[model samples]
Target: MKDKQVLEFDLIIAGGGAVGCLLALSLRSCGLKIAIVEASAYACDSQQSLHPGFDARSIALSHQSASYLQQLGLQSSLLENCVPIKQIKVSDQGHLGQCWLDHRQQRVEALGYVTSQQQLGTMLYESVKDADDIDWFCPDSVSDVKQHQQHIDVILSSAKRLSASLLVVAEGGSSPTATKLGFQSQVQDYQQVALVANVKTDHPHEFRAYERFTAQGPLALLPNADSSFGLVWSLAAEHRDTFLHMQNSEFLQQLQQAFGYSVGRFVALSQRNSYPLALARLARTVAHRSVVIGNAAHTLHPIAGQGFNLGLRDAQCLSTLLRNTVKQDGDPGAAPVLQVYSQQRHQDQSLVVNSTDALVRFFSNNHGPLVAGRNLGLGLLDLCGPLKLKLGRAAMGYGGQNAAS
Candidate 1:
């Protein structure tokens, strides 16, 4: 029998989703041997298996996120397929309070860009695919992980042994690997479900996004590159099945009633998909030589569209620390290095998590006073230029880094 050989690397990322792939791309110039172990096949051809995190769904990339990708050297190839969101209109259903945020007013190119998840994922994967320093283990996953004094050892389901100086888990919420590694997450169910679909309107989108707060939940219509609107409608848990299975025409009618005729009439609808909404987070993100990031560290409500942006920031911060450590020829998984990452991410993570949770709870109700208050606040926000500027900056994911400047 031949002796089993073990592959070694400076870092091993356990998830090949958007976050993990982006992290790998961010570290391409860091001169580290990187391994990405993904259970799903890195298949992009239409006839191949579907990638979970990079499905047919679409996502809004904040201005900061776009800048981060550009900094990672994906500007020319990526961003071309994205549609810019020049303006965002926020309002309450059947109320007079509303506000408009314009990219021109914010002194930036655009507030954000919308693109299909599959395109971004494929592009990131392509960029890292040919790199000599990066190795991909697709259709395989980390079945077991053990942390040691100097390095962490990983055992793949294929019985391949691997060793790494650090292990980063981006396996997402409800990750079995994270659970096996003794990471406990506190999950708060919002009792709501988000129904997402691509919707077509009778008129052009005009590069605008809308957030309408209905009594039941919040509905968002983001401009898509295909000249359609990507709809993310949050509804009570009980209504999940009804909306998911509703006739296309009826669904459009209900959507129109909730969103009004601001974006013109809804003419067509695509297949609907849904997932239960919740807030999940770990008390601590670092454990020994391993660290949890992306959805593994915190899963948030999508009310504010901050979940992915927040996860990307996690990758950005960790890569910064790891790159610096590599330059210094120091240990990337050292306790001090991991500690600094945890401490630095806590503030931004907490703010986004808490505020997203608050928005879900506050906006998903019909309390007379709260409704009046929020509407009034919206009115004031529109009237006050400074407040509008601050909100726009924050919406652009500038809470930590000032991408606006």
Candidate 2:
């Protein structure tokens, strides 16, 4: 640790979200000087309140992503509370349409994991608490930013100036700061909103996640450790309010209608959240002395629950780039360096976004011809081992280095 409190660092990150915080913590063992400029300080005591054992929003993490998390020294404690999604079930309601994917059929130990987004944050937060190298700033935000050949300077809302060789923004999909820094994005509002909640089921989920396509949209029920399914129910934006305002009994009935009986009866749910759905792709993933990770760079449909996986892959790829560069005495924040990082990330993200978006469109309609074609496609996929394998691999995020680390 440096003796002086206000000092420069090798990296300064904007936004204290999971991605940004994980980036700093990942680089800790390198002993590189780093500081995080969080918009909000831990000003509110409520911020420290850890929900039950896990968060409402969970993640479908690929084997590669799990390995990457483990590589960062985070799997043991993280997995302790996480449920292993041994298989994934994709089907439609009432048509007897269903397909199953398991590691054995896929020739892997496990397809992925069902992990709580907040639990991972909590684990990282605890793990990094004693690491003296990475400085965290919360309850404060970056007000002004300046970049030059040598370093980047930032003025916080508190009028404090901080500098670093490189800056990373991992706030979320929509960030004004990233926009001001010349980050233009191609955003497609799904015209839909994802309604998230949890529900206790009569039968155990058996460690499986379901992505059931419907006329309204795709409703996903990911397994919780208990006999419950964490739901990410997406519907057309126009109908979102109806779902939000439904009385408890009405909500449960609609949930039953949307989710179906794969998980049995619904008892109750909590931590309900409604978010606007969209696909936003940044024009350029990196620049002179800064880079974007997490939701700030790209956000995809939750149809596959691959949003965080995409961000985790970004972090892993960026870490590899940084590691390889310093090993060769290359500048970490060089334009060419950042550009390379962007290129590598762009190709991989393209596939994820396209596949997820296509699935959303294919499933969220009632066209007679389209319905028949999709049902045929699903049937064909089930019959053909090679085709099914291809999709399983793709969904498991093995498209390329963009996914499989």
lDDT of 1 by residue, 115-170 (tens): 88887887888888888999988889888887888889999999998898899999
Kindly report which residue stretches of model 1 are placed more than 4 angstroms away from their true locations once superposed.
1-4, 47-50, 401-405
TM-score of each: 0.97, 0.92
Number of the top-ranking candidate, with lDDT as the measure: 1
Candidate 2 residue lDDT tens string, 245-318? 87767888887887677778887867577889989988777877999998899888888877778887888778
lDDT of each: 0.88, 0.77
lDDT of 1: 0.88
| Model 2 TM-score, all chains together | 0.92
Error of 1 at 273 (Å): 0.9
Error of 2 at 28 (Å): 1.6
- The per-residue C-alpha lDDT of model 2 at residue 237 equals 92
Q: Candidate 2 lDDT (Cα, whole model)?
A: 0.77
**Candidate 2, pairs of clashing residues:** 39-140, 40-138, 40-139, 41-138, 41-139, 172-295, 172-296, 173-295
Q: Which stretches of candidate 2 lie over 4 Å from their true place?
A: 1-6, 42-55, 402-405
